[model samples]
Target chain A: MEQEKRPEEVKKTSARKWTESAKKVRGLVANMYLRAITEDKPVAWVMFTLCNELFVAMDVLPVYPENYAGLCATKRVGDPFIDRAEADGYSNVTCSYARIGLGYSALWRDTGEIPPFAPDGGMARPIMLVGSSLVCDTRYKWFQAFSRYLDVPYYAFDMPGPPAVTAHRPDVREQYMKYNLTQLHGLVSFMEERLGKKMDWDKLDEIVRRAEKSYRLWYDAYMMAGRAVPCPFPAEDSFRCFVPAFFMIGEQEALDFYQGLYDEIKYKVDNKIGSLPEERYRLLWGGGLPPWHTMGIFNYVEDRGALFVFQSVYLPLNPADIPDRITNPLERLVYSRYEMGIRRAEHDRKLGLFGACNFVGLGNPLLFVDEFKVDGVVMHWLRSCRGATIGQIYQKRLLAERSNLPVLFVESDMCDIRDYFEADWKMKFDAFLETLETRKRAGA
Target chain B: MYFAGVDIGSTMTKVVIMDEEVIASVIGPTGAEHRRLANRVMEEVLRQVNLPFDEISYVVATGYGRINVPFADRQITEITCHARGVYSLFPTVRTAIDIGGQDAKGIKISNGKVVGFVMNDKCAAGTGRFLEVIADALGVRLEEMGELSMNSRNRAKISSTCTIFAEQEVVSRISEGVSIEDILAGLHEAIASRVYRMAERLKIEPDVVLTGGVAKNIGVVKAMEEQIGFPLLIPQEPLLTGAIGAALLGKELTLKAVEGGKPVERGTRRLEEATFFE
Candidate 1:
C-alpha cells in the first residue's frame, strides 16, 4: 500500500487581489449619472474618444453612451436593449455598442422615463450632443442617430485623415493638425454659443494640465509597474482602472485615484507581491475588447497560472514635443495626438514590419512581446465589431513571424453574451495552455 | 500496473485499459446521459480484462464530456490527447486533424508534444454532424456515405458550408435529379476544404494524421489528401486514439510517481453505475 494525493489536490489556482481605486471608481461613475439628473448643469452626450476634459472644466455633465453600453453589458442588462435595437431594424451586424445605445435611448424615449432595469438609473437625457470622428466612424454616427430621438442640438467635429503610420510625414502631419485645430476651435465656439457662455481659456488650460499629470501617473502605474516578474496588476484590474482615465480624466478625483493606484502598484512591486502567488505564464491580450459579460474568464485563466499582463487597448496618451512658443492648450492637444501617431508609425517603419497601408494593426503588440516578455497571445475576434476586427488576422500572422509565439483567436461579441459558448472556450483554453506548457518545458 | 483511459465524446464514449501493452478496449455510443454512458463503457472495458476498478492504478479522461467522468483521476483536453496518440502511432507525424461529432480541431505536434492547435467548435458547418445532417437529408446511412461518394462520376458543388443552407441545397439538387453519389461527393469536398484551410493555419507538415469518427470516411480522407497535398496516416481504430492517448498519459504519470518514490494519486475507484445525481 502507498499514500496518494487526492485528485482535487492536483489543481492549483491563486486568489486575486484588485486595487481599491478600481472599486471606488464604480461609485464615482454612478455619481456622474446621478448628478446629471439632479443638477442644473448642462448635460451633454459625448463620445468616449472625445476629450471630455473640456466638459469637466466647464462643469457640464458629460454622459458617455459608449461607456454606458459597456456598463449595461457587464451588469447583465444589455440583452433587452440589443434585442430592441435589432427589432427596430438596426442590423444585427451593426456595432453592438451602437445597437445597445440606440435601443436604450429608444426605450427611454418611448416611456419618457428611465427603463426600469437601466443601469445607474440610466444616463441623463442630453441637453446637447458633442462628438468627434476618431477611432471609428460609428462613434460620431451613433451620436447623430441619437440626436434624432431627443431633438437636441448636435455638434460633430471632423478629424479624419490618414492612418497613424503616416503621422511621421511632416506634410501629412501638419495638414491633419491644422484641420484638427480648426475643428477644435469650431467645437469651442459651438460649446460657448450653445451654453450661452464665453470661452474660459485659463480654466481649460488648468484642466489640460491636470489631465497630463493624471495620464503620466496612469502610464507609470499601468505600463511601468506591470513589468515585474509576477505582475501585480492584471488585465481585469486594468480594464476597470481605465474607467477613471477615460471617463474622468481631468477631475481631481481621477488624478487622486491614479496616485493611489500608482502607490499600490509601487508597493506591490517593491514587496514582490504578484496577482498570483505562482505565475507560470504571462499572456498578452493581443487584441479586441474584453467580453464584459463574462469577465470571470480572466480569473479562470489566472487560476491556471497564466495572467494577462498586458492589453493592446486603452493605452495612455503620449504627448509630442512642441515649441515653447505654442501657448494655446487646444493646439497642444491636437499636436500631441497627431505627433504620437506619427512617432508610432515611424517606429513601426524602422522595424520594417509593415507597409504604408498597414497602419492600424498590432505592430505595437509585436513589439510588446519582447518588451513585456509574454509567453503567448490571446485575441478576441469580436463578431459584431467589424471595424475593430480589421487587421486582427493579419496581426496574428505577424505575431507568429515576429515572435514565434502561439496566438489563440476566440470569437465572441463584447456585449452580446449569446455569441460565447463556455464549453468550447474552456476546451480551446486547455489545449492552448498545454501547448504553452510543452513549449516551456522544451525551453522554446 | 493497470492504467485506464475514458473518452466521453459528444457522439460516442470509448475506453481503453492497458498494462505495458493494450489489454482491452470498448466503444459505445454516448447517450444523453454522459455520466451513465461513461461508467457503462468503462465497466465493459474493465470486465473484458477481468479486473476490478481499483486494480487500475490511474485513469485519465478526455473529450467533450471529459469533465462528466466522475471516476477519473485527470481530464486532459482531446486536442493534446489526439496529438499524443497520433504521435505515438506515427512518430513522424507533424500535424493531426480530428473531426469529431460536434467540433473539428487541427493539432500541430513536435516530438509527441502539442506545439499549437486551432479549433472550430463554434459552427456545425465543419464537423461530423454536418455530414450526418446531409446524409440524413439524403435518406442515406451515415456509414454508407463514403462508399456512395466513391461511386460518383461528377461531384456536384456544395456552395454553402452552413449545415442548414447545405441541407436545403442538397434537397434542391435532389429535386433537380442529381445523383445521391454526386451530392455526397460534393459534401465531402466542401467539409474537406473547410477543415484543410483551418489546418493550414498551423502551416501543416508531413506525415499528417487524421483521427476521430470522420476519418473512417474514405471519401473525406481522399478529398483532404487532395487539398493537403500529402497522404494522411490514420490509426487502425480511428475512434479510440483519444482514449489510447489518455491511457498512455496515465501510465506515464503512474510511472513518474513510482520513480519519485510516491504512490499514484488514485481517487474514486468504485466500479458502480452512475447517474446525473451523485
Candidate 2:
C-alpha cells in the first residue's frame, strides 16, 4: 500500500538554524495582534508586500494577510480558507494566495472566531488595510474585497509591472516612481492620524540602515548558489530564510538571520558539499512560485539526485539596488520607489535581466541557464496566476531553441490541493529526469 | 531476450511483449482493481507467447497505475512511453497528439525524442471518456458512433468547452428533434477543435501521428485532419502504443544493466525521505 501523504515541515539544519529565527518572527507576527488586544496598540494590515519595512519603521504592529496566506499554503492547510473565499463568490479564478487571505478574513468576520488552524492564532484585526499594485491585477483588488469583510478602510499604492522605462517613453519611469511615493506618504499620514502619534525620524533612519544590511546579506547568500557547487541547505530553506526580511527587515534580528545563512551556505560551497546527496543534476526553478501543499515535490527531486541550486521566486531586493542614501525616512521611502521603477526601466533599456526581474514573471531565463550550470529548467504553469502563467509556451520554445536544454512545465495550482494530483506530478517529474538523461547521453 | 510492458490506464489495461520481433499482446478493461487486472493481463500475454514470466529480461509498468504494478522491475511515465511507442512505430513522425482515457497530450518529437509537449489542463473536454459519455447519452455504442457520425450531412456546433455542459446541450438538441448523427458529428468537431488548440500551442509540425483509444474513431480522425490542417499517421494499434513504449524502455534499461553490471531500481527515494515536511 502507498504511504499516506503528509505535509512538509521545516527541515533541521546546522548552527541553531535560521528556521528558529523564522519561527520567532512568526511568534512576533501573532504577537502583533496579541499586543493589539492586550496593550491596545494600533495594528495596520499592510497589503503591499514590500512596505512591511515601512510599517516596522513606523513602530506600529503590522499584520500581513499575504504572509498568513503563505503560512497556510506552506503548511498544506489552506483548503478550508480557500473554500471559504470561493464560497464568498471570490471566483476560483482568483489568485490562491489572495483567495486564502479572503477566505480567512471572511471566516473570522462571519463566525466572530479565529480558525483553529491559523498559524499563531491567525492575523490580528487591523485599524486599516493597505494595498498595492503588483504583477497581477488581483493583488490590490483582493485586499479591497477583504476590507469590505472586515469593515476597515483600505488604502492602496501602485506597484508597476515589466517593460518599464522604454526609450520611447522616458517619462513613464518618472511617473510610475512618483505615483508610488505619493501613495507611501498618504499611507503614513493616514496611519499617524488613526494611531494619534507622530513619525519617528531617528528610529526610521536606524531602520533604513538595518533594512539595507538585511537585504544585502540576503542577496549575498543567494549569490553563493551560482558557485560551481552550491551550499547544501535544502531549497525550502531559502523560502524559510525569507521570514525575517518580510517581518523584521529593519531589525537587527533580520541581519543576524541572513548573515548566519550566508556563512552556512558559503561553508558548504567551499567544502564541495551539495544540498542533495548524489547531486547528479542541477535544476533551475523559474517561472512560478512553489505550491505549498505539494512541497513534497522538492524532497521528491532531492532524492532523485538533483539539487535545485536556484529558485527565482526569492526576493530580488539588494542594498546596492537602492539608488539613494537619504537618511530622512520619507525621502528614503520615496527613493526606494524610484529604485524599483528605474530597475524595470534599466532591465528593458539594458539587458539587466539578472538584476531585479528574476523575482517575478518569466524574468527571461537566458542568463540563468548557463551561469548556474543548469541541467534542466522545471517551471510550473499555475491556473490561478495570469501574469506568471503568461508566455510560458514562448519561454519554453526560446529556452529550447537558444540553450538546447529541456524545459518541463508542470501544471498545478498554488494553494489549492484539489487541483493537484500527487501521482501525476511524480510521474511527470520522473519523465522529465529521463528526458534530461536522454539528452545528455545523446550529446545534445 | 524477452521484454514486457504493462500499461495500466484508468479505463483499460494493455500489455505488450517484445522479443526479436513483436511477441504477444493483451488488452482488457481496467475494471475495479488495477492490481488484479495488471497481473491477469501480464499472465495472459505470457501464455499467448508460450513463455514463462521469469524468462522476461526486464519489466516496465506505465500509465496511472505504474506504481501499483508491484511485479514490474521499473515504473515509467506514459508521456515518455507514448513518445517511445510512436517513435518506434513511425520514426519520421515529428509531432504526436495522444487523446488518452483521462487526458489529452500534444507532443513535439524530433530525433525520435520528445523535445517539447503540452497537455490539456485538468479537464475532460477532449478525452476518450468525453466521447464515451456522449455515446452513452446518444444510446449509441462507442465504436459505432464513428460510422454513425460519418453519415451526418450537417455537423451541429458544440461551443461549450466543459464535457458536462456539452452533454446537457446534446440532450437539449435531442429533445429538440436534432438527429443523433448530426449531434455525434458535432461532438467530434468539438473535441477536435479542443485538441487542435492544444497541439497548435506546441506549434504543429509535419508527420504528426494520432494515438490512443480515440484514434480508432474515424470521425475524430477526420475532424482532427480538418481542424489541425495536417495529415495524421494512425498506427496499426493505437491502444498498444504506450505499452509498446514501456517495453522499449525496459529493453533500454536492460541494455544499460548489461553495460553497468548491476540492476537499476527506478524509484530514487524511500517514502519516508519523501515525507518532505518533517
Candidate 3:
C-alpha cells in the first residue's frame, strides 16, 4: 500500500492486485447470470454491448466471452481451446478474438475451470450468446456455434452498413436508432420474464446518465493530456485506462474515478508540470503508442529542443475530460447499447484518424508544428500498425508543399526492438534536425 | 469564383483553394481536436487571399475526417477524391498508387473516375507508417531514410510482418552491430515488398500516379518503382492531390448546379459569397 516504491515493485504489486480485482469483478458479474440460469431466467452472453446490459438489467449475469478469450490468448491458455475450436471446424483464419472466445467456451464446457470463476461443481446457468455483425463475421457465427453447443438461446443484432451515400437518400440513422430501441425492448422483456422483476426504466436511465457522464469526463481528461505541455503519460497505459472504462462503463464509481483523474490532470496543466522541455522545433508523433523500443525517439527529439505536441490518441473514445449532456437518458442508453455493439467503425475511424490526420495529409504532426510554431515533423511509420500507415505519403507531401515545412517519415516497429538500427535512426534524425535549424535560420 | 477543397485525412488535413487552378493551399496537423483545426486552416487559407469564408463558391471535404467537417457543402471519400485529383493531373493515369502514411491504396481509374480501388488499411508493412517505424528504430529521420538506404552496400532481411514484432527484430540487429545503412535498405525493401503485394492485387498497370506522403520517401519510391517494374509520375504537389480533386469536384458540382438553373444550396451560396469577397 506504500506509494513511494520502485516502479518495478509497483508494477509487480499492481499486477497482482489487478489480477485479483479482475477475478473478483468477473465473479461478481458472473454470479448474477448463474442465478438467472438456475431460476430459468432468459439470459445472454454478449461480446460487447446490450445483450450483457439486458442480461444485467434482468438480474441475469452476463459473461463477456471475448474478454475471457483475450485473457486466455495473452496468458497462453487458449492454445488448446483454439485447437479444439479448429477441430470443431472453426477456421484458424477467423478473427483471433472470436476464435479464442469460442475456444474458451469449448474448453470451459470440457474442463469447467476454463473461466476460473465458475463454481467448484455445478452446471453454469442457461446462457444466451449475443453479438452484432458490424466488426467481423466471426463473432456472429461464433456465438451461434456457442449457443448450439450449450443449447442456450442466442440472439444476433444485425447492423446494416450506413445507407448508401447519396443525395436525398432516406437517413438510415433513424433506422439504426429504431433498431437499437427494438433490440433493447426485446432484451428487457426477456430479462423481466426470467428475473421475475418488472423492468426499471428509471434505473436504466440513471445508469445511462452516469455512463455518459463518465465517458465525457474521460474524453475531457484525454484532451487535457493534449495541452501545450502535456502530462508525461505513456500511451501503453491504455490497458489500465480501458479496464474501468469497459467494465464499469455505466456506473457512478467509474465516473468518480474519471473525475478524480481529471482533477489531477487539471492541477498538472495549471501548474505546467509534466511539460516536455522547451524546444526550438515542435514535432508531433502520429501512430499508436511508440513501443518501448522507440521511447528513446521522444527523448531524442526533446533533447534537440523539439517537443512532440499532440497526437491522434485523442480521437476514439473522447478522453474522459469532456462532459456528456444527453437529454433523454433512455435514448442515450439505447444509443450506447448499440453504439458499443458497432465498435469496429469507431475503432477503425480512431486508429485511422490517429495516423491519417496526424501522419498523413492533415495529420497531428503537421498540426503540431503549426500550433507549436515548430520547425518539423518526425513521422514514425510503425511497421506493426497497418491502419496507421494509410495516409503518411499524403501527409508528408502536403506538409512540404503547403508550408514547405520539413517532415521526416521514419519506419520503425513498436514491440520488436531487435529490428531497430539505432545508428541509422540517429544519423537521419540528426540530419533532419539540422535541416530544420538551418531552415529556421534562413527564414529569420 | 474560387473553389476550395479540404481533405480532413486521418493524419493531416489539407486545404487548397483554386481559382480554376490552385491559388493557395495549407496543410497542417490533425490533432486530437479536428473541428478547431479545420476552422483554423480555413482561416489561414482565406487570409492568404484576403477572402472571407462567405466568398468561396464551394467547399468540398474528402478523406477520413470529411464527415466531421461542419462547413463543407459536400463530403466525398478519399477514394473518389484521389482518383479525380490524380486524373486531373495526369489524364492518361490508368493506375494510381497512393501510399499515405498509414495505408497503401491502389486504384484503377477510367475517365478520371475510380472504377476499382484496393487498399491495405489493416497492416503497416508497406505504408509510410512502416517506414516511420523503421526510421525511428534505426534512429533516422524521415527525410534521411532515403539517403541512408541508398548508401548501404548490404541488404539486411527483416522478416517480421507485424510492426510490433519488427521493432524487436530491428533492435536485435542493432545490438549485433549491423550497419545502419544496410538496416535501412532492408527496411525500405520490406515496405516496398508489402506495397508490391497490394499493387499486385489491383493488377496495377503503367502510368501510375504515385501520390501521398510515402512518395516523398525516395527510398520507398525507388523500391516500389523497381518492384512494379515501371516508373511512376509524381505530381509537383502529390499531397494536395486529394484536396485538389475535392476542389475540382466542388467546382464541377457548383458549375453544374448553376448551369442547370438550380439555386445553389445555402452552404454553396455561402461559399460563393466567401469567394466573391476574395
Candidate 4:
C-alpha cells in the first residue's frame, strides 16, 4: 500500500470493484433477511441514523426498509409498492422509499407471506425496530407507522433539539451528549433483554476496529476522486460506492473492496485515463439524494465532458478524520452516533440557530465543493425529502456566490423516477452548460 | 447573421428571430407534436424574415418541450432565458415573475443572468392553469375573468390549497349565489398570494418584470403587483421573452465561437475560499 501508487488506482479499478462491492452488499442484505426467515435469527430493522455500524457489531441481522425500497426501485418494480402505499392512504407525497416499504410491510401483514414484488427473500419480520431523527424526520413517523401496523416494539433514539437543550440553557451540550450516550446504553439493554444475553465487550471492540478501518478505506477512496484528474468515476455511482460504508461497515470485505477500488482508481489517475473523454468541468453534487432510478439524466452532462467528482452522499463517511473524543470502544460507537449531530448543532449554535436537523446536510458538502476543485454544481431539489430540499434554494445561492461557479438546480426524487421529467432536466443541463460556457468565455 | 429561439411552453409555443434587432416572431398553441410545433415556429420565423432555415446561425430551444424541439441547436432553461429576455427588455430589472400555463416562477437576476429562482411546476394552483380552471367553473372565458374581477363589489375568499378543490369550491360558491365578480377577484387574489410567497422565497428586489402568458391578465397582474408591493414591467410581447432570451443567448454563443477560442479568463483567476462551518 505505497501512498504514491494511490493516484494510479482509479483506472486500474475501473468500475469493476465498485459494482462488485455493491453486489456483495446486496447479497449480504438478502442473506441477512434469508437467515432471519429460515434460521429464525432475531432480526432488528434499522433506520438511517448514525450507529448502523453499532447494530452490525451487535451481531443482530439488520433489515433496512429504506435500503430495500432502493433495491425495488433499482429493479424498476417500485411503482406497484408505491402505488399500493398510496392506495393504503399514505398519499403520494410521502417519500417513495417510505411508501414502497410501507406497501411491502402492509402486504406482508395482510398475506403473512412475501409479496411477489419483494426483492431477494423479502425483508425478514423484525422482532423489534430502531429509528432516529436524522436527515428526514419522515423516518421517525415512517418507523412509528410500521411499529403500530406490525405490532412490534420500536425504540426511538437521539439527542433532543438535534442536540437537545432544556429550553432556557443553550449550553447543555455536555449534558446532552451524555444523555444521548445513555440512550444508546438503553438500546443495548433493550437488545439484551430481547435476545436474553449479556453484553460481549471484547467482540464489540474487534467489530469497531474493523468497521473503523472499512470506513477509513471508504473515505480514502472518495478522497482519491479529487486527487485523480478527470475523476475515473461518475457521481451517479456514489450510491454504489457508499453501499460498503453503509452495509459492510464492520466486514473485512468492505475494507478489501475499498482497498482494491483505491488501487484501481489511482492506477487510472496515473495513466491519465479519465472516466469521461475530457473532464473539462469538475462538478460537485452539492445537495439532494441521487435518483437511483433515473441517473442516466447525467449522461447529458457526461456527453458535454463534465464529471461529477464528489457527491454529498459520500460525505458522511467522516469517521476516518474525526478524532475519537471517547476512549471506550462501546462509548465511541455512541459518540459516532451523536457526534455528527452535536458538531452540526455546534455549527448551528455558533451561527445563531436552534432546533436544527443534521446540518451535515449543510456543512460537509461545502467542504467537498472546495476540496474537489469543483468548476460548477448541480443541486437536486428532491420533492419527497423535504428536510434536504428545504436547504436547496439557500444552499444553491450560497454555493454560486461563494464558489463563483454556475449552479444548476433541478427538481427530482431520490428513489422515484415517476416524479422525474427527463425533458425538463435535460433543458436545465443545456442552460447550465451554457452558463458554464459563458463562464469559460468570460474566463471567470 | 441570424439566431432563432423556440419556446415550447406547456400551453403555447413562441418563436423569436433576432440579431441586432428582432426580425420576426410567431406564437401558436403547443400541441402533441412538440417537434413538429418547434419546426413550425422555426419555419414561421424563417418565412417572416424571408430567410432559409440553414441561414440561421444557431437555435436555442426553451420551456417544457425545450429538449423535445427537434431542430434546436442548443436547449436552454426558461429560468435563464426569462431573466436574460426581461433584462434585455428592461435593463434595470432585478426580479422577473413568469406565470406560464403549467409553471409559475420568480427569478432573481443580476448582471442579466439568473442568480436565484423558484418555480412551481409542482401544482396547478399557482399557475395560469389556476385561472383556466376558475374560468371553467364560472362558465366565463379566460380573458373575461380579469375585467370581471376589476369590477368586484367585494372579493370572496377561496382557501383550497389544490386546484381541483379550489375549482370545486368555486362551483359551490356559484351554487351558493356568490357573484362571479367577487369569486374571480378571489381567484386572482389566491393565485397572486401563492406566487407572491414563491417570489419571497427568492427574495424579490425592485425593477421587477412580469413575463409569460399570464402577464397578459390585468387582474392577475394587478393582484400580483399589489401582493409583490411593486409595479412590474410587462414585456411588449410578454409570452415571447423566453424565446427572445434564447435567441440572445444563441447570438452571444455564436459571437463567442466566432472570436477564435473560449471566453477570456481574467481577474484573480484563483478562488480559494474554504471555510466549512462558517
| Best candidate (score: DockQ) | 1
Top-down DockQ ranking: 1, 2, 4, 3
Better of 1 and 2 by lDDT: 1
TM-score of the first chain in candidate 1 relative to the native first chain: 0.93
Per-residue lDDT value at B42 in model 2:
81
Give the per-residue Cα lDDT of candidate 1 at A390: 80
Candidate 1 lDDT, A1-444, residue by residue in tens? 001111122122212347666667678879988988898888999887547778887788899887898887777677778887787799887888999888877777777777777778888888889888767767777888889877888899886645545656778877888988999889888888888897788988888778777877887888765587778888877888888888888898889999999998899889888778888999998888888777778888877889998787666545455666777889877765666555666666777755332224447677578888899999888888876678787888888887899999888888887788878888888888988998998999
Q: Rate the local accuracy (lDDT) of all candidates.
A: 0.82, 0.74, 0.61, 0.73
- Residue-wise C-alpha lDDT for candidate 1, range B30-71, written one tens digit per residue: 878655657778878878989988888899999988876778
Worst 10 residues of 1 chain B by lDDT: B269-278
Best TM-score among the predictions, by candidate number: 1
Docking class for model 3 is incorrect
Model 1 compared with the native: what TM-score? 0.94
- Residues B106-132 of candidate 3: C-alpha lDDT, one tens digit per residue: 777767755445566455677777877
State the DockQ of every prediction.
0.72, 0.52, 0.02, 0.24
Candidate 4 — which residues are off by over 4 angstroms? A1-40, A52-58, A133-136, A148-152, A158-174, A265-273, A320-328, A338-361, A394-407, B1-3, B18-20, B33-59, B68-74, B252-278
- Model 4 TM-score relative to the real fold: 0.85
DockQ value of candidate 2: 0.52
TM-score of chain B of 2: 0.92
